[model samples]
Target: MKVIAVANQKGGCGKTTTAINLAACLGKKEQRVLLLDLDPQGHCSLGFGVFNEDARDLYDVFTGEAVLEDIILPDVFTGVDVVPATKTLQAAENLPVRRDERDRLLAKYLMPIRDRYDYVVIDCPPSMGLLCFNALAAADLVLIPIEMSLFGMHGIDRMYDVVRELRERHGRDIPVRVLPTLVDSRTRLCRQFLREIGERFADDVLPVMVQFTVRLKEAARQGLPVIAFDPTSTVAVQYGRLANETMSMLQDDAATDGVGEPATGLPEATAAVQHNNPANEAVPVLQSHATPGGMEESRKRLGTMKRVFEEARSRLSRQGGLQKVVLRFYDFTGRDVKLAGSFNDWRPDQGVVTRTANGIVEKIVMLMPGTYQYRLVVDGLWQEDPSNPEQVSNYSGGYNSVLQVEEEHATEHA
Candidate 1:
């Protein structure tokens, strides 16, 4: 079985969410999946509505009080079995195993039942401890979920350093792929950060991005994967795409003898995987929905998402009386210019209106009297307003054009 460890030392990066949903989506593809919760917080089990204060966990397995299969919670979701975690699992970090063998303990235990499942998805803890080390040492692939923020991208260098160390010690290469989570595509800041990630990580970044939505929170509250809670939601579609991409990646790795180069694009076709289980059918996974012949399908699925975000922005904009503030760009005459700022919740398409004249572009936004931070999207790229001298740090190693509006002259151009 291929083991995918969803790992990140940073918290609030959607690490557990990716693990639970990815497992559920993989199970939907008719693959036998084992969801292993290694986090002491036990949030993965909690996400699945199976968190029990008293349960046989990985700690028991590590201590030799129980075997791996003995604690399996079978069929939590279709074709998915869960090895749930409790708070006591924290004790496993202090197990008295020899230093060299501690890191390989998980890999050793997984060997016996490796053939029973097609995949083992491990939800790692948020710290670089023995548990996290065990997960990484045992991982065939490390899926890192990066939240779209400055702090979210922090400590990733440290993670890569650890991965390099493990690779050298294990004498095998473990491929890593970054999945951008909680993406809000409508915002210039988010879009800019996404571009920055692409430039920085390049081929290591996956094509599929998980969009920010309240429905995911609701699903977690209801103890169900987004698929089971709302099968038709856009987030669900994204997770489904992630599963397809992951399978295609594993297939590619298998084809190359577990040392394939980083995937830059979707595979044109997939070869079916043969399983050891007699009853299990051969796996013929497809590329992510949007990357293949499903462009129109993706557009249809995202329609609801767009409408929901627009309606929410409309409601928020209506909360206070708005005054017109004209912003001028003298340099970009023929280029397409749009405005995104704090006044419109950073969404480029929300409250900003644009007009072009002789060698100048004017963007007018309606806002209540207050200070605002804004950016110009010139021909699909983000930059601070050159005409505006005032600026503030965006905390993502960049600056934002700052504007101050008062009730006395709210109608005047800045």
Candidate 2:
């Protein structure tokens, strides 16, 4: 089975949302997906409508008190299974030295029944703690979710550093990729930052983007993924695309290895990543290194970085937020065009539907810098936006169009 960890050192970057939805989307494709929620907050269980926590969970699994087989539950969705977490998992942080063993524990537990599922997706906590390390240790691929924010950008460097540290210690270079979330195209700053990220991460960034959408929050409230809640929503479709991209990447890796799988042990997979990178840091430096300027200097640098991030947040906040956005749909000859989304609480009838020149349909509204999922109702028939390529499965036999209202001068469309 391929292990993919959805992780980021930054909180609220859509990590849990991505983890749950991606697994659900993969399940929709008939791929057996097991989502291990290493997050102490236990959002996965909540997503699945399981309010009652199991007395035994990942805490037991990690502490060797319970077996994974016994703890694994499939109540989340049809083809997706989940190993939920609880507050007790926080105890993992206090795990002692020789931590690489703890890191490797996930891999060890997963090895026995690894082939049962096609993929094991782990939702890691938003910290560089032991739990995150364990997830990284077992992962074949690390997917980092980054919101379009100042703090989000700063965490990327720290996340990279953690990956490199793993590479140096384990002699296996873990491949990490960034997935931009909550991307608002309406903001000039958001758009420009995205461009900068594309230039910097380049091949390391996933092609699919998740727009800021309240449907994600709604789905959680309904105890379902957006794909299940609104199968035709744009965010759901984007998750589907993300799953396909990940599968394709793995397929290519297997072919490259010529061994029918990404070379057996962790070292081989890491080495493959190491060999594949041309633009990233080279191999020699990937080796173990001494602490640069000792612990005190590292602490001082971290303080400086914190201050820098604060300044960045202040600067970016000014450049982002609510703006006048125009939602337009073109080339529609339908009777009336209505819009429904979270902005209007998904009320189809109350939306202002107007017909513009050249058969162009449009709705002008002020929106903040975030992702939103909306669909056009053309003559009483709900449809995905023709002009907007960003969409997700609404699970209602249709699709909801995605719109990113960036924090720019305005006039952005979905």
Candidate 3:
């Protein structure tokens, strides 16, 4: 099953809306989908016409008082199930366990039903607390809903730091993709921000942006996903495009391994691509190393490097929350290295890996609390870091290493 969490630290970013609509679209396409409302507001449940004053909700699951089968309720729309939310979610902060343990609560609950649905979409609250951490820990991928405002970028660095910490410490490899939502094409600032994000994120950015539209509100007011409420609307069309793109990515990811199943409900050609295509070979690895100044260096890098910046937790009395995971590349000869990847637009200079005092090349990056897969760029070549033992070969035959950050309550909560 593919579990996706729609999250954003900044409020009013359309995170809940995306979760509701995206689940609806997937269901409309005949795919089995489950929408888990992690937000205390329970907007997702209300959007699907399943609100009840005394319903058993996600809170039951978190505390182990209920199982998924008991809380799941059919929505007005067919093929979609919802696990509603209640005010109890707000109490997560007060749980007796350590903070990191709270993040694993959702994962423990979902473990039982992981394979029941084709897609599990989680709608997260607007803070980096136990609730959001639980959603992140339970998710296979994270969809960050970014608004077109200047402050939109404010907490993103912190989010990245959390993701990195989760991966390096926990060994979870969750991939995160950013989605541009509530975009106002008319505003120059919005347009500029979109362009900058596109240039900065490149392929990591989704092809379709959710434009600011009245229809979105209309659909919400009508208590239906945008696709069902108005399949012909612009927002609906954009959502469809996003769904298709997401399916394509999953299929591509599966092809490298003999594992991933083809996406149902797509055209024959699309399905073919989604399935294994021997013709599509993995790209060659790049060369990377670190320099003396702690910067990462990549040799023969051809694209722009996308850097995901995040905030470092404060260290009032004890050691700081966690240090950033540094990515450095070294040549076979142990010389300084360069870096390249989907984030860096494959450009060598984007993330220059610097050498260390002990002759090690490295670059430090702050990632959010999740798992991340990356490779190194050596002298004009791309390859896995021999210094690190955790590596996996993608379907493309390229090597990738997994890094995990421990959620505040991962162990205690689990």
Candidate 4:
């Protein structure tokens, strides 16, 4: 089985989110997946609604109280089993072990269950502690989920160094792939950083990206993976692509293991650049990594990726120039709520409200720079936004919340 550890030192980069959903997506394809939660916060188990305060975790195994198989929660999600973690797992770092064996503890434990599943997806903690090292030491492939932001790239070089150290120490060549998460292609900053990430980590960047969407957050609150929550959602489709790409890379690695060749499934330095200066033009970022033979398939894959991106750009061109505007309502305890405004012809059916983890009801709508009037329909009662003080009197007795969106306010809260 191929063990993929979803790791990044950066927080809020969708590491756990990727782990949970990727495992679920892989399971959807009839692949047996074991999701191991190495995070002390136990967010992965929580995502699957399987968190138990009294259940035994990896902490018991580390201290010789239990074996790896004993802590497994079988069938948490279809075809996915979870080895849950708890806050107690953090204490395993302090276990006294020989210097040569500390990092390989997880690897040693995983030996017995290596062939039990088709894939093992690990949700790693954000810190570079013993837990993270143990995970990296055991990983066949390390998938780094990098957010498309300035600070998201921080400590990436250090992470690369850690991976190099593991390769040298363990005498195993573990491939690393960068997956850009929470990307909003419409924003100028997102597009710029996406291009920069592609150029900088060309050899490691994956072809697919997880676009910014509020539905992911909504899914988390509902304790389900994005695919299980809404299979037709864009993020769900993107994660499905990610699972396929990951399997391809792993298969290529297995096939080329004895030949001393790199996986050709991952295109080196080829990025589909989406630009708005020309208004809906897809540009290919050129690189010098092209080879004469065997790597020809990489070029074909890159061309196909560019064509797919171009089609996405064509779709975006129709609704391309709009900025994101988030309308928030608090203390909403209704079965359903929706936004009706002039932006969408004041149709409530077009905008469905989503509640976040913090219990804040929100509706994200795209609009051009202009002033528009909107109201919230909470279970059948029309009301103004409680958070926004700006309002104007409508023809009815109540007021309509006035939202003024500008180009400078291109902040996307999704």
- Name model 3 segments beyond 4 Å from true: 98-101, 254-414
Model 2 per-residue lDDT tens digits across residues 91-199: 7666553633756777777876677788888998765667787788677688998887654564467567777766666655467778889877677656755665664
Could you tell me which 10 consecutive residues in candidate 2 have the lowest summed lDDT? 278-287
Better of 2 and 3 by lDDT: 2
Clashes of 2: 29
lDDT of 3 by residue, 1-414 (tens): 677889876666789888988888788778788898888778887887667767887767666788778988875576789988887765654456655555666676666676777788899876666677767766666788887654455456567667666555455455667788888888665675676566444344555678899888888888888887888988897787666666656545542211132223322211122222132322111111222221222221111222212111222113333335565444345553665433333355363334465554556543334434456666677776676675444323355554554544221100
Candidate 3 local lDDT, residue 362: 59
**Candidate 4: residue 169 lDDT (0-100):** 63
Task: Show the lowest summed lDDT stretch of 10 residues, model 3.
Answer: 281-290
Considering lDDT, where higher is better, how would the candidates rank from best to worst?
1, 4, 2, 3
- Write one digit per residue (lDDT tens) for candidate 4, span 249-286: 77665632211222344322222221112121123431
Specify the poorest-scoring 10-residue window by lDDT in model 1.
278-287
Relative to the true structure, candidate 3 reaches a TM of: 0.62
lDDT of 4: 0.73
Alpha carbon lDDT of each predicted model:
0.74, 0.70, 0.62, 0.73
TM-score for each candidate, following the candidate numbering? 0.63, 0.65, 0.62, 0.64
Per residue, candidate 1 scores C-alpha lDDT tens digits across 93-130 of 66677866867888888888878988899998766677
lDDT of 1 at 386: 81
